[model samples]
Target: MTYKPATQDQLLAIRANAGIAELAQSERYAAAEPDLVEAIVEGVGQFAAGEWAPLNRIGDLEGAKLENGVVRLPDGFEAAYQAYVEQGWNAIAGSAEHGGQGLPFTLACNVLENLGTANMALNLLPMLSVGAIEALEAHGTDAQKETYLPDLVSGAWSGTMNLTEPQAGSDVGALRTTAHLIEEGEHAGKYRIKGQKIYITWGEHDLAANIIHLVLARLPDAPEGSRGISLFLVPKYHLKDDGTPGARNDVRCVSLEHKLGINASPTCVMSYGDNDECIGELVGAENRGLAAMFTMMNNARINVGSQGVQIAERATQAAVAYALDRVQSARAGAEDRSPVAISEHPDVRRMLLRMRSLTEAMRGLLYYTAGQVDRGDIGEPQAKARAEVLVPMLKAWATDTGIEVASLGIQVHGGMGFVEETGAAQHWRDSRIAPIYEGTNGIQAADLVTRKLGLEDGEALQNLFADIARAAADEPQLMALAGECAAIAKWMREEASLDDRLAGSVPYTAMCAVAVSAWCLMQQYDALDDSNDADRKHAKRVTMRYFLDHIVPEAIGLKASATAGAALLYELDSSVLAA
Candidate 1:
């Protein structure tokens, strides 16, 4: 069954968990009145359902294709993208100075959650564009901003990040792409860029009139490694004096990757300066490309976290719909012992509840993280540091949870889920890439323990644990979970070796993420009062109870794995370990 966008109620509920009301209080988002935000939410949900959801299966089955140096999306994919642009959905979170609606980035996160749930593959296009906006906004020169920001913010021209190469996936410093100063020509003072970038999302798509490639390349006389690389804006087409796309540039999509899923979004092998004519301009200060790229990367990281909630919501919905419809063997409690829906079975109910509760928790994590980003933007004290601390773990934890929930979704379907026609497997396949995208979840874990933990001398994480512990103090399990994580954080900081920290990072990240998620649920639970509708409060109670009772306990039980040093992992030699 094709799943539409998550319901308005669910999106609104998750937004509440993120404290949309609090965001509106900020001068940055003062114009985002409650009614306006609600209307946007409702409209985005409807658009996702009516347009994007229908293409999910089509895109998966047909995928995007490479032809004649251009990447062609599946049928209706072009129109859907155009519709997305035409609807101004892309502009919501953008800045007003650049033709955007100036809404909160948190709201945009909610919007993408719906679009991603509807169609993750197609959704990758604009998601990258938004990241580019953040990058240029922070680093673009006045001329660069005047030239590119409006179109990108308006979505008439899309954007992409080009970092990975054949040999340089995680190591940006190892990239072979090079940029040369164009000292004496019409394009003098610009650059001639040359390199092949693989796994470039939306690199050569025909959805927009132009694609602005934010590429990392080293220059002559540059230092070795990442510190030497610079950010360059390479356009697929040269801009006319009038600012519209003009002549075609030398860049082309050499080939498209055949992936396990999200096939509708072209993962291009983009070659720049095939004819030695590709031109680019510097973005920020020389040799500070990594700093500029991290702006987009960090933005993309948080966006990637939402992919977890997207797939989980879709998978959970599909699983529940199937469970409620597929009749199975007789239930002992059924009248006359007649056959009952699979949902009535004890194990099935447990899986369904687990799916729902985890989805809720992940959804909360996504919103809360995005809200932190917004808070940071508005200059809220400590918000920026906390967002840095949260982004890595949120990416690592949420994507892993998405995979878990998607797998459980398949399990809920029993035999039918193994077959593609049922569409359950696609969610699993589509979801498999989130952990690998942005940065591998392993990298996210490493960042969480290393740099993020060291932020403000670890005061940021200390602040986060304090809030969670305060909110969760009444619940012994949650309080213990918080305390254990606090103790572990301290141990990792002062005593554990780097290897030990890395070994324990994944489990430790899962612990903090779940504890934080539980804290979010607890906050929501506490906010309810007698004036709230019974059904609303009851559903919240059940979801929170299930998470606290089942999921929190399982996460809390990871103490041993989290604190276990790296010695055991390295005890066996590489040969034996591989063998």
Candidate 2:
């Protein structure tokens, strides 16, 4: 399936709505001129479409294969990756002091959005590397950065987070991986990592020269559970005297996972220190590995949310194309009652509009959050807090939207959608894993209510609501809905029990996401108010109106359920609930 990215105008409109111009005015991002940013974004989209899009199907069908410890991707993947590296795409958001272009991280997110939409599986390799770069940049020793940052930033070597062991799913403390100090000659200072990790994405791949495995393991005589865990920089190959990749480390991919989607990207069952010589260097303070790994996980969570937007965008495009091309029954209201294309059918129109509007809103939300994160990075306290609130919503809500939109894509396809060859099924399959990973959507919602809502004693949420109300001043309907959500949030924080809060968190999250999404779309509507491009502005206007008319009310309807206490939920018999 072919992929298309947001237009330059659309991208800029999102940035404008998010107030990204403030970042450009700062000395930190002064180089991010409007035209330059637009050109770069458009160029990345073009590259994604032209290079990686072709590999989507091949990756899905061929998948990644493991043979005798080495993992391999389908043909053309390596060349496309090299093109990706050659184009300097990987260095877009890295630090200038560390071989990056020193641009806004927002633009880098845009790059990932585009590239991942084209081929999300293939994008995982570099995405993980970006997170690793972030962790090391924050915690790695100077020697570690000097040896690793150059290769990692340039995409010559990939990074993997080895957190999941077969026994430990979401519980990091349950892991049994062991690491010990090497008290020997040449490697005296380094530690040895020994254990197996499952579900390691891009754990061992042929595309990069070596894989940097960030392993979480326990040291001897340490406290048990999560506190005992320490992070290690275990590489596929040990570096030589000149800081180049040299000897093969003891780590290897014992096998590859048989997964539901993103097949081209290897999900490996990694075996570390089988020969008792998996040398690794410490990343940060001992017993604080979870903190360091969370730096990567938090980054990965947002990017995982981006997968939802990417898949939704692709699915929406596919649905729209199919709707325009596939003619079926006659439209009841048409002057000529002959059979018409599905696009002309009213119900189909609703589905298509829902897909279009929600996808656009999600795109806006992702950009808005990314832009705030950029501002927060530059010392904006409020921006940081608000971004924290938005991250869980983006991760939970957007991925849920992704699944919904992709399923709609299949529905739009009718019978053909169920078949694998149509690609609609593939989109849904790929999207299925999103909400389950990167801290499940439910976990995200719980975090929102339990943690983020309490920021500044609920003023953070109120501030956001107040902004929504201010933005919705002319639109009383949206203002009313926003108020309803605020009331629910207040009730959850002030009156509701923990059980009640947990029970209602999912609905509350969806409600807040809808309110925030409306807030985002409102910005787009405002940004396009003076646009000379008639079609673009009209599209925005209609979609905004569509969301207000069709979607916002559904969220409004969620108020009652959102406020419903945990009584009914707990009353259910366990056997019956299971049955």
- TM-score per candidate, in order? 0.98, 0.98
lDDT of model 1, residue 407: 94
Every model: Cα RMSD to truth:
1.4, 1.4
Which portions of model 1 show Cα errors greater than 4 Å? 2-4, 7-15, 333-335
lDDT of each: 0.88, 0.87
Per-residue lDDT over 87-184 for candidate 2, one digit per residue giving the tens place of the 0 to 100 score: 99999988888789888878888888889999999999998998899889888999899889988998988888888889889888999999899888
Which pairs of residues have clashing backbones in candidate 2? none
> Deviation in angstroms for 209 in model 1?
0.7
